[model samples]
Target chain A: MTFRSTLAALALAAGFAAPALALDAGTYKVGFVTDNTGPLAFAGTSFTRGAELAAEQISGGGYMAVGAKIELVQKEGAGDAARSIQSYNQLIADRNVIATACCILSPIAGAIKPIALNNKVPLVIYGATAPGLPSLPFVYSVTGLPGPAEVAMSKHIAEVAKPKTVAYFVLSDNEAFQGRFKASQAAMEAAGAKTLGVVSVLSADTDFTAAATQAIALKPDLMMVYTTQSPAAGIIAAVRARGWAGLMSANDAISPLAVFKKIGPPLAGVPFPVNFSADASETPKAKGFIEAYTAKFGAAPDLYSAQGYTAIWLIAQGLKSLPGKPSREALATALNKITELEHDVYGGLPMTNGQAGTRYTLFLNWTPDGKIAAWKP
Target chain B: MDLFLAQLLNGCALGALYGLFGIGFGLVFATMGILNAAQGAYASWAAIIAMYAIELAGLPFPLAALAGIAAGGAVAVLVDQLGFEPLRRFGPGNHQAAMLGALITSIAFWIMLDSAAGLMTGQQSLAFPPGSYPATVFQIGPLLLPAMQAVSLLALAVVGGGMHWLNTRTRFGAAMRAVGWDPVAAALGGVNSRVIVVATAGLAGGISGLAGILAGISTANISAGLGQGLMLKGFAAVVVGGYDDIRGTAIAGLLLGVLEVFCAQYLSSSWRDAFAYALLLGFLMLRPRGLFGGGGFTRA
Candidate 1:
């Protein structure tokens, strides 16, 4: 068989790992559109694992109706705007798919939102944190941007640095990162800091030295970086290499341990807010998630996986709430009615019109050893 | 002035990487007469292997990197034998059709490599151990170069110089030129054109492997599709520098890298990508044969 066929076979087998053996419960078919191939593959892969874990939990824990099995139909989004729509359409058109959780990139979610609305297939956004993604009638967001947490992070940094000026390094094309910059900036300015300047690069940009030099040239007392993990690692190294080390913070995109391994001990004590942390808290569900995720994936769950797990968990819970056999419209109504829920990933999160308000406990600091712990300061 | 100097040094450092990355693409195009679309995948494979060696086997920096580079060459050879050779032999009747067939095969191989990398990496980015390489700062008057950048610059010099020597002064270079020009005639003359093509592919893969590892260490752009941006930037350099001219490609890569930095710093960082694209378009219109022009494809 060709490599393509082999991969397709593997995907088909993996997606259908849970056999529908539920005696009396109607099989609830849900769809997951993933960007599992390109630069954003990290999120897609992790999110899928999270969804798998949750799907297993729903079956074993009887989170759904008795003998009610949840079938996850996954389509490859390929992490592009055009491809996401095609994938979403495939999910919506066939197989009685009640709802679809899609995308780790916000831009893609935005692109597919209109299509989902037109099809009236409830779209549960797994991880697109772009700011101001309007939660429409049929659309819901599980992963909100780190804006609120960035504000909290700014407050935390203010307690330590109290910088009077701030400079920004951002992924200019990424609305999510830009939202983070804006939030961090607002909080800093509220603390009496002035904007120094902003230097930007595209999301795919690798060379951060030039942008870093320009940002540091402004000599801001504090530097706030808001980009994905790869750029976050590069910019951190670049800025530190140039000795702009008054105080630095970044969003949770850099929370991955692999990224910390590259940036090295330079990441020590850098504060960032995220939506999920494997740092076991007083919350039992979170502790269970950490253990389960680590046991299955061999690594602690990060933000993307948490978003994926929560997306599924939310969908399952919504499906469970309905009295009769689950339908698409009922599932949509069930999802919207759930304004809040206690989740393992984020403390209190469900879908809303704008930001799905979540627990800010993921405000994190990097341990020198490239692992993360809940920030004390 | 100090900041300008710093940016200049940084630009040079980045350009060195870009040049090293692009030169491999130029080498494959020059020797094989086809774009190795899988060039990025080979880079990624090498990087993942290197990272695995470091993280799992506890190999030190240089040894682990060498292992990855060598693996890259081996993988390239395998692809050449399995993917490209079949296309050349049984694909199509015409030259253009065969070339296109080979290109499509490379792309298929690229996807295949990406899937393999995705599986190996668990679709997560891996990095060298934090202290695997020291981040020492080397200062020159007003300029500062970090250890990573310094090492990459050094690599570019050796690579660019070595490729130049190999292309102009070696028997292997002659074989490669002969093979690239007319494989049938070269075979008639006992040049062992197949061996030349395979060796050239191996060398190209090794260079891209170096580029991948360097990128991982310096920028941490290490992932399944990590080489996509490199492929784009490298292809741009190749197009602007003349596809067959390695030295010209390297120089063009550096120039593009510096121009990107200057535009981002002095002008608008938001539209910096557009500026580089505009430069690429201008080069295409003004100097279609590239800066060095051409002495045909074989004169590399």
Candidate 2:
């Protein structure tokens, strides 16, 4: 036989043998779609692993229906909406997963939320904080809305820096960020802060020297940077290079430890809210999570990890309330009813409306020693 | 006035770096009559390789930079040999086919390089190692210029001066020029055209690698796609300066940088790129021969 025929024969053999290795009929599948590979892999993988760790513990320790263990089915979206949608469909159609969780990107989550509602499956959003998300019933957000954070951030700037004038440097590459930018501008103006100007930069922009110079010349009390990681570093570096000593604050986009290491000393004193802090072992549950996460993963959990871990627990809470095999509607209702609870990682969350969590946004500042610490508002 | 002056000097410094980057694009085009799109990929790779050398291999900053430059040159030579050389030898005899083939092949190679880089760096835009460059600003009268700005300009001057000396004073430059003039004729004249082509590519890649490092220092972060925009700006400089004229290319790059900052300063920052490209379009329309009027594709 020719090479093509030989390869086809081998593939046919594997296809024939596939059903013999199929999963058990009683296996309950839970799906997760996020950036598991590519630039966003660090966050995506952390989220997936967080959910996986919880599922493993629950299934192994018999927290679910007797004789039925949960299998975590993860799809790598890589921050693309189409890919995320594809993964969501695969989870429903191929794996018959009861629930889907952990979409970090606003666009991807926004796209898949409607699908989850239509399919009668519950979606737990971890990272995306878009204001429009909570209105959908089947979708439960484990994160704060960007509107609250923007309001909080503006008020914090007004309270601390007390700048009469503030300039905004926002990344306008997506609708989600644009919403946050508009909300911030409105909040800053409402707080009696005069706008020097609003400057927009592409997330992929490599040079922010010009933008930095322009903003510096304005000499605002604070320069609000709502930019993604790489551009945030560049803008911050350029601003500091030009000797602009004014306070710089951002949304959660700037909270990553990678940003701290990249911008180095310039990052010190810059405050942003984080969903989780490794140093935050204030609650016993948080302490348990830190210890367990370190033991399991060989490193401390990040914000994504905490969000991911909490997302799975939220689903498990819904699952545990059911006396029998939980239907999609029942599970979503249970998730919707989750209010005023403590999680293994994220402590004291309140679920309401279609949204499932209170704003647990903790402000953190980069220290001079290249570490991040909790900052009081 | 001080603000304007500061921005002006900043523009000049930025322009110098742009010109430094533009040289790689210009040099390859001047020699090969093809725009090597993989030039940006080489530049990105150089930054990444340099970062790895420092962050992972524990090499000192300066040595890491040299390693980066060497890597750029080596990768460029490899691309030429593996991708372009065979096309030059056996691609369609038509010029259009040859040009299109090279362009498509270079773009494909760039995609492959990007994928490979993504895999290696986990798509992370890494910061330069701490203390990579001292953040000191020098004030002359009212102008506040970062020390990195001066270094950028001085480096560009050295690069331009070295290139000028190489072209005007060296035997290799003479053979290289001959090949650019007429490769077949140069081959008949006992000069190995292949060596000249590969050498020019290596030299261009080395310069681009330097640009990448400087960009990392200036921006304080480096990503795989960082070079794409810079590559476009550099190509615009090459086109605006009269393609084969190195001095003209440098001058045009400086002009573009200054113009971009002025636009961003006076007008909206969003209009900056629009105004720069408008200038490019104006040049292509009004002064098709470019500012210095050196032969580009036609002569080649």
lDDT of 2: 0.78
Scored against the true structure, residue B197 in model 2 reaches a CA lDDT of 93
Q: For all candidates, state DockQ relative to the true structure.
A: 0.45, 0.44
Candidate 2, residues A87-120, lDDT tens digits: the string is 8888878535878885777777878888887888
For candidate 1, the docking band is acceptable
Q: Per-residue alpha-carbon lDDT of model 2 for B1-300, expressed as tens digits?
A: 877887888788888878888888888887787788999878888888898899889888889989999988898999999999999899998888788899999999888887777776666777677676666888789667888788889878899778868876898888877887778999999999999999998999999888887887887767767678778889888889878778878888899999988877787667778888998899888887678855444522
What C-alpha lDDT values do all the predictions have? 0.79, 0.78
Candidate 2 residue-wise lDDT at B103: 91
TM-score of chain A of each: 0.88, 0.85
TM-scores for all candidates?
Answer: 0.90, 0.88
Mark the regions of model 2 whose C-alpha exceeds 4 Å error after superposition.
A1-25, A37-42, A82-92, A114-121, A178-192, A322-334, A337-344, B285-288, B293-300
